[model samples]
Target: MTDLVRARLRTTVLLIVAVLVETTLGSDLRIAGVAPDFMILVVICAGLTGGTLSGAFVGFWAGLLYDMFLTATPVGLSALTYCLIGAAIGALRTSVLQERKSLLPAAALIGTAAGVLLFVGAGDVLGQTQLLGAGRAWLIRVMIVESLWNAVLALPVGYVYAWVARGSAGAERVGSPVRRTSRSAVPTVK
Candidate 1:
């Protein structure tokens, strides 16, 4: 199979597995009254590893899958939030962030925190007052705890995402190699 096809296939499998795991064991793996948002973590990892478009695509589908399980909120809320977060994270990685051992967890930490705020803010604006019914303090707590949880899980998920995204357009961009032309090939300025 072509590399692009293989990469896309792997991506499909990864998303399916992630959604299954998140839906099944995610709640059971709570810490400090907060469950790890594995779906969001996957989206963040995709962004950090695969670049902006990759992240946005993955985030949209993943968020849509997550939305299927939520009856309280409107259908597209999670999709919008995850899609934006993924795209933002990807853009940041492309423009400013460097490849490093700590990049995954750091992105997850910050992305999740921002994502929580965005989700709540957008939900409130969409007439989902229940998101803000608990007040700012509750929101803050959820943000801190969930961000931490996602950060803790980022490394493993990132590695998996990198493997799954192998050979895809964005996968090849991570830790992009700097092109170096030989000095001898340069024309002399006589």
Candidate 2:
């Protein structure tokens, strides 16, 4: 399989794992009643490393999965939010963002804030006003804390993504020959 295809398949699996982790295991891992948004972190990582389409695709699936696990909001709410977040982050990547140092964590931090707002707004529109249940102060607190958590995860997640995509470890090596199944590379990248 081509590297791009292998990369995308890896991203897809990660997305599923993220949904399971965030909604299932992660939900139980709250700090002051707030759990870090892992799905957003994963999608942001994918987009920052994998490019626009990859971001959008992963974001949509990850969001949908999260929606399924979290609330009764319409299935596509999180999907649409995450999809847009991924695309926006990917587009931002093309211009001033330096992938060398500023890319991964920056994307994770900003995207996490945006993703939280987007999800909350979408939930509000869908009549899940409970998102605002904590009130504005609590809402801002959620955003700030979640953004911080995502930023903390950004480096490690981004490095793992780089390893999966380009076989990187800071300015060290090029591609290390890797094994991949060809079928895993097809539908996702196309």
Candidate 3:
């Protein structure tokens, strides 16, 4: 089998395992009245490592799978939120950010916080008032705690995501030598 096929297989297997773990042990691993969202962590790491399109694609599937297991809101809610979040993170990484050891945790921290707000806000806008039923204070707590949790877990998850995404076009771009484009000596008229 080709390396591309192998990478896709690895990514698929990783997502499956992540979904299983998030659905089963996720609740049991709760801390301070909130559970760590492994799926979101995976999505964020995928985005940070794989770039915009890759992140969005993974986020869509991960959110869709997560939606299947959710009873609180409509099926597409998580999918939309996660897709946007992943895409945004990936775009940011590609444009504004550089690869660094601390980037994983920072991305996880910010991504989770953004995701919580987006999920709740989108749910509320979609008339899923129950999402905001917990009130603002609860939302704040969840955002803080979840972000922290994701930040702590970012490194391990990032390593796994990198492994899974290996051999793909985007993955190969990461950690490789930066390519410089040749510039013309003469400036073109607008």
TM-score of 1: 0.87
Q: Each model's TM-score?
A: 0.87, 0.79, 0.87
Question: How many clashing pairs in candidate 1?
Answer: 0
Rank all candidate structures by their lDDT, best first, as comma-separated numbers.
Answer: 1, 3, 2
lDDT (10s digit) by residue, model 3, range 117-176 = 999999999899998887999999999999998889877776677667777655522322
Per-residue lDDT tens digits for candidate 2, residues 1-190, read 7765676676667777777777677778677777888888777766654456767987898888887875556788889999999877766654445434544666678999998899889889888887788799998988888888888777766655556655211111111112221212212222
Q: What does the lDDT come to for candidate 2?
A: 0.68
- Whole-model Cα lDDT per candidate? 0.79, 0.68, 0.78
In the range 8-85, model 1's lDDT, one tens digit per residue, is 788888888988998889989877777889999888877866667877888999889889989999998999999999
Q: Candidate 3: minimum summed lDDT over ten consecutive residues — where? A: 181-190
Candidate ordering by TM-score (highest first): 3, 1, 2
Instruction: Single out the weakest 10-residue window by summed lDDT for candidate 2.
Output: 168-177
Candidate 3 is scored at a TM of: 0.87
